[model samples]
Target: MYQGIYGSSKKHESDLDHVINRAFKSGVEKIINTAGTHQETIQALELCSKYENLYTTCGYHPTRCNELNESNEDEILKQMIDLCEKNAEKIVAIGEFGLDYERTQFCGIDQQKRYFEFQLKHLISLKKPLFLHNRASSQDLYDILYKYRDEIKAGGVIHSFDGTLDEALQFIQLGYFIGLNGCSMKIQNNLDVIKQIPLNKILVETDAPWCGIKQSHASYSHMNTQFTSELVKKEKWIAGKMVKDRNEPCTIIQICEVIHSIRDKKESFDELCETIYLNTKHLFFSDQ
Candidate 1:
């Protein structure tokens, strides 16, 4: 939502309230707004305070790691920790942070690894679960996470997971949950990997308004359902209408339906939904 719909620079502000209301009406019980920078983290917390059942994460994304340097890294880390401490009730995790090797042009490998480890080392003390992001840097990401496994007692979710089955198993073995979203089902292999994830260790998300499923995705064949909201191009967006190609939280049902179609038939659709909901609660809202 921060990157696409609700942020200061986004164009869909006129329909923001409608979109959020649609999500809750569609049976979305809670929303976790992920922050990718120190500034976004603050914004997420402020936004969460205005709405019920809304939560946020705290940390910088790998692609935005360049914002840190020897001069400001310590101050930024302090600021993140202060936000977590002051608003512990709303700040559920310590990420949107991890390695994204695919976009090294935005921030080089050395910087990404350095700050990824830096955040992991510093933020683990907060005892919050992680909201991680890993793209094409699994081994290095795993190594870093594995190094700090014992300290991460709350566990975490690898949000928008797009890794091999072996990699998924490794993260699960480390007691992490695999977060499946629209982007997670983009290809045949993605579907295959998600199919093998144990039901108890899976969480589903929209990762909106970014990872909405597309017709070209392998999982689209299973999506015989859709939301009825009118779609319009962002340039011609109207209040109460969804922007075309911009994902919203209400589309999460389609994601769950796709998972139901691809997973073992032994579990009914309601059972699958229940299992994923419980998994999410276990990781991010266990105290409640």
Candidate 2:
């Protein structure tokens, strides 16, 4: 990935591969890498093409709305569609696309809306499930997806969902699975909302190098992993083989642990993990 917000410097090329290998060793079977801009989409495609277990999505993020206007829309859409179509077996989804009213100042609401609608419309022809990111624009995002629900043959996932129970339920009604990451489950309310969601509709992700557990409602004292809180020195932490303060794929297990803490007592720990793993596979890998 690019090393900065301006996207100037680049990180080590093999960094993602190293992290992914560490994650797979820690019981992670598959990963869905997100590509929200033209550059990101290209990087994701290259990585997915190299690793069988790594899947990727191709679309422009709402934050990058300014990056896509009438000038580059046609070229961007064609590149995304062409890569997805040719590598349909590995380039599994089309998203990281949605609304973000929070950052409307950066890119106007109208422009973001237009860009979002364009991706949705074009993706329909590709027949891929969407990997969406919605922040404070649920209603608009929902309306757009609802309008094209029939055309979306593979359905989609609301990744790193931090919406209300009602919003979650609304997406459920539309037949999309809700994705949960560390930040998504940081608060007690997050846990409460997740409790309301059926296990069948649950999907867990790392959102890595970003969404590690900020704070769990209950103490992680009982966490079964050796990478405990003691290792998390305010800014730096180590889990499995990957070492960094930023979230990494290996820590996905902690996301599952957090979910288990708030889950109903009816199921055993292993059973719950199996259920969620299968649900994720069903959402992102069922077609493959």
- What does candidate 1's lDDT look like per residue over 3-63, in tens digits? 3444546664456578888889878999999899989988887778788888999998999
Off by over 4 Å in 1: 1-13
Local accuracy of candidate 2 as per-residue lDDT tens digits, 165-282: 9999999899999998876876667778987888788888888878766544342432456454434332232333344355677787777776776775557878888998888777
Q: Which segments of candidate 2 are over 4 A away from where they belong? A: 1-14, 216-223, 226-241
Clash pairs detected, candidate 1: none
lDDT of each: 0.88, 0.77
Q: How does each model score on TM-score?
A: 0.95, 0.88
Which TM-score value belongs to model 2? 0.88
Best by lDDT: 1
Task: Please list all clashing residue pairs in model 2, or write none if there are none.
Answer: none
Which RMSD does model 1 reach against the true structure? 2.1
At residue 264, candidate 1 shows an lDDT of: 55
